[model samples]
Target: MKEQSSRKGFAKFTTLDIVLMAMLAAANAVMTVYLSQVNQALNGLGGPIATSTITGLYMIYGLLAYYIIRKPGTALITYGIGAVVQSFMGSAYGILSCFAAAACYLIIAEAVFAAFRYKNWSLPVMMFTGGAMVPVWFFFAAQMFGYTKWGTGVLLVALCVRIMSGILLCGLLTKLLGDALSRSGLLRRFAVSRAVES
Candidate 1:
């Protein structure tokens, strides 16, 4: 009989990890609501780019949580918590839609991390994951807003814009934020903290 391979990396979740996940999830919810409000305010006046520019910011919490926790299921848990918080805060899309979007992001993020065996925390891999999230993001948005019939050219353009935004906001900006937090000594126990320290 073949022996079962242990999920050694996912063996446990410390109290500290749980606390950090909760805090990060709440932070993401607040930031997402605030940014969405800003986007709505400037949307029509400033053009579509105004809202799209911040699309990547939506992935920030998930990225940070994954980096800090370095464990499987972190994305799902954090994003799920954030979705609930956003719904309660009166998000324009309602609770279900918020959760749906968060789920989509989680699916993509989790798959990407799994592909790398959760070992590649390099900036390039993070950026790739960020960019990869655009397709899923666009899919849910299209369904929610009834944009499923958008022409190919238009959809392509929109996807490209989102990918660009993801790289900038989720990828580079996330790294910057992580670096700052790591430097503050708050993330000393996390793997990402060591990367920053070195």
Candidate 2:
């Protein structure tokens, strides 16, 4: 009986779910290579602040996958697959950094959704989730990229920019894209489409 219940629970993820996650992960991996060059140029132009502006874009795919799937482990699985895809795509951040980035996103995204019991898909909640994913990874990145040496004021400004970017680029963009996809009837079999219809 217990094994049957477990299987039933796992069955929540249809094959479509797996396929969508893989597609999003692969897209993210390819985008990461291009974005890294953009980030490098931005960093050169305006320092951490400029680079921070696009940080949320790096996180969008996993958040988008979760928004569309609305499942407990959606972000985690998507991000994990993204890390693997990024490795093969030759990310400038190195394989370890790619995995680390995914891990960072997984931690915050899972915790935020789990905290809400994975039920609240409201705009505010999504924005909060996106903004929340920034800080912990920012902590890790500060040390790695020497952002700590940039003085407290500069660090705080950069952090704020990143959080806002997360809210707009990652969270808001995910919601909008999900809704658009839902409307197109392409996501008809997904949880998000059901949510939209009801």
Candidate 3:
């Protein structure tokens, strides 16, 4: 029963989290609407680009959710929920694209977190969690949408863009969130768990 309860908790995000994610998705819509042309232009110029890295909204969403619910399925639920919320709201991405994005995030994040047994809430692990956003970022926005279908060179460039965004923006945001959560004492047990790992 306790385990079931824990699972439920992992699957459930608070009302605050929901509101935050919805806002994020709405912003994504606005950004995409306004900046997609620039993004296309940059990709044309750079041979693949990290345009989505501009806002760093999704990174914050993932990091904040992980910070609050440091348990298995939490990352997946929050990411998936955020995508759904974004699609349901007036966000830029269509419902199909949102589904694709949510699936990529859910699968990759679960794989990484499961490998770590879902307890590595340290800075690095959290960073990796944020890093996982990269593939989905491209998978949904670029590949599924036919951007990567341009050519092999374009595909490789897209991959580079994803990695660059993950490292520079997502990773940094995750570390910042972890630090803030540590300061807030919301992640005390996670701190000890990280210490044990080291």
- Number of the top candidate by TM-score? 2
Model 2 residue 164 CA deviation in Å? 0.5
* lDDT (0 to 1) per candidate: 0.80, 0.91, 0.60
Candidate number with the higher TM-score (2 or 3): 2
The best-first sequence of candidates by lDDT reads 2, 1, 3
Summed backbone clashes in each candidate are 0, 0, 1
Whole-structure CA lDDT of model 3: 0.60
Flag regions of model 3 displaced more than 4 Å.
Answer: 1-47, 50-59, 136-143, 184-198
lDDT of 3 by residue, 4-28 (tens): 9987875565555555545544554
Estimate, for each residue in 1-198, the C-alpha lDDT of model 2 and write its tens digit.
999987886789889999999999999888888999999999899988999999889999999999999888888899999999999888776788788878999999999999999898989988888899999889988887678999999999999999999999998888999999999999998989999999
Compute the lDDT for candidate 1: 0.80
RMSD per model, one decimal: 2.6, 1.5, 4.8
lDDT of 3 at 109: 69
